[model samples]
Target: MKRNVRLVVARLRQRLTAAGNPGLFQALRDGAAEGRSTGRHRRVD
Candidate 1:
């Protein structure tokens, strides 16, 4: 199950890179961090 999840995530990342949005994930992570600082309890993963 964990392997499958990793494969899916890898594929999605490849697709995102192909589409020229490689920094998309990083931006989202940064946004999540900012939200956390504001006391948001949302889980990105």
Candidate 2:
């Protein structure tokens, strides 16, 4: 199970690099910001 997860992560890294992102940190930050912006449109419990 751990090995499968590692392989998936490695594949993701390769794809991100191929797409020319600096790294996952920037991608995650941007995603978080996007989620937050969209969340403002919904009611929170």
Candidate 3:
């Protein structure tokens, strides 16, 4: 259905953002580069 396809597209967008954006998936690396700053971990659940 159309709604199902929309949901799939939204999920794909989230996956792409998480994978492509360093500020998102690379939080630990980013924090470390900022002189050991602490950041909240990304939530997957």
- In terms of TM-score, which candidate is strongest? 1
Residue-by-residue lDDT tens digits, candidate 2, 1-45: 778966875777777778887566456546656768886423323
Candidate 1 lDDT score at position 5: 62
Give me the runs in candidate 1 sitting further than 4 Å from their true place. 28-45
Estimate the TM-score of every prediction: 0.54, 0.48, 0.42
* Backbone collision tally, model 2: 0
1-45: candidate 1 lDDT, tens digit per residue: 778967876887788889999899666557657777987645565
What candidate 3 gets wrong by more than 4 Å, as runs, is 21-45
Winner by lDDT: 1
Positional deviation of residue 41's Cα in model 1 after best superposition, in angstroms:
8.9
Once model 2 is optimally superposed onto the true structure by TM-score, how far is the C-alpha of residue 20 displaced, in angstroms? 0.2
Looking at model 1, how many pairs of residues clash? 0
Query: Best to worst by lDDT, what's the order?
Result: 1, 2, 3
Tens-digit per-residue lDDT, 1-45, candidate 3: 778966875675578687886455355334445543434433333
